[model samples]
Target chain A: MIIALTVLLTVTGFFFFFATTIGLIRFPDFYSRMHAAGKGDTLSSLLMLLGLAIYSLHHFSFGNFLVSLKIIFIMVFIFLASPTATHAIIDAGFESGVKPWTKEEERAEE
Target chain B: MHFIYMFLIMFGFWIVLSGKFDAFHITLGVISCLIVSFLSLDLFFHETKKKGRIAEVVRFLSYIPWLVKEIVLATIHVAFIALRPNVKDNIDPKVIMFKTRLKKDLSKVTFANSITLTPGTITIKVSDDEFYVHALTKKTAEGLPGEMEERVGKVFKEFGE
Candidate 1:
């Protein structure tokens, strides 16, 4: 049962990652691409790490339990860090004056 | 009091990370935690008082499940937009600015981070009470600083009512 859950979570995470990549390539501009990279990456990594953490506890040993706890700590760190990093990157782009791609701009270009 | 709490927390972290129960390693952990906590006590607590902190933490913990649900919805929303063949027609990205009433620096930072984590919106800048956010669609753009602000306010006890 636990292994089934782990596989399910990990596979779902991989699917999101694939979607993120497609979004990154297909999105029109920098800011939009960031939407994919930042949000998708955070969720996918969280799910993947959570799966690994659960799987580590499958053996039910104290050492494995500690390792699982460590994985959770890493998840917390990533959860805090990823969004901040996304904000920083987007802020830099704004400061550098990279204009966002709006629907109006696309219509005007055509 | 704060120093002791800090030391205990740091020591707990050290034990979990180091994973050693021997006296020698335990002593080393204690020594490092003491030194580190002594050096950074102010950084950790920073103007925070002892009063109501536990209640605030409890409230914050309760907030996490809702945040996680929103994150899942957000990812699915993004994925839907990304997967659609008519992606350009779907997204109407715009930069929107608004004023927030959250006064404390910590509350403001929380609100901004929450914005970045939520659906179709990312916080670009925060200056004083003003926020500049980028929204991916008209629908998401319209939903700015809505229930989220109120929820975060409750977590931080910003709302006296």
Candidate 2:
């Protein structure tokens, strides 16, 4: 049962992940694209990790618990690091003077 | 009292790494923990008040999920911006200075770090109640001091501010 739940969550997470990836491709402006990617990646990783933790509990052993703890640790680290990385990238773009998308502006740029 | 807590943490880590409960290993764990803890006494001394430190640590731990959610949202935002071929070209980067009401050093730092962690903002500098942030877009610049201030304020409360 736990395995099934895990698979379901992982699948759902991947769906969002790829959707954001596509949004990065299709969105007409930087800000809108960022809106999709930032929210999508965070949710997907979190859901996937929670699913793995749930699956780990079914085995209920010392080693398995420790492994699960390690996974949690990684998730926590990513939780901290991912935002910092994103901010850095955005800062770089801003420093370079990139302009945001607008309706009329988008039509002209394309 | 302080040594006891350090000993427990180190011993737990030792057991986790060594996967042994033998007498010799246990003895080695004690010695190693003592050595490390003794060397780290400066940290304990700096945090002289013990009554609230543990609670503060617990509070910070609980805040991790919220922090993670924020990060994930920010990442998705940036990736979408970066990958859009046509949209990627129009980024208007500008710096804005704002006044913050947060007083404590730690809270101010947390506020700055959190702002810089989000996709479109970078904390350029912070001084007491003032912060200079560089935003990738006007929207992000406008959102500054809204939700970010509230979260950082809560973190300050954790530290007994």
Model 1 clashing residue pairs (backbone): none
| Superposition error at B42 for model 2 (Å) | 1.8
Error of 2 at B77 (Å): 2.7
Per-model lDDT: 0.92, 0.70
Show the lowest summed lDDT stretch of 10 residues, model 2 chain B.
B84-93
Cα lDDT tens digits for candidate 2, A12-76 = 77866787788767766554555555456666787788788878889799888877777787777
As a whole number from 0 to 100, the lDDT of residue B160 in candidate 1 is 89
Which ten-residue region of model 1 chain B has the weakest summed lDDT?
Answer: B41-50
lDDT of 2: 0.70
B1-161 in candidate 2: lDDT tens per residue? 77787778877877766666889998998898889988986775564463766776676677667776776666656655655565545455556899987887767767776776566776755656888676667778889888768876775573345
Judging by DockQ against the true structure, name the best candidate.
1
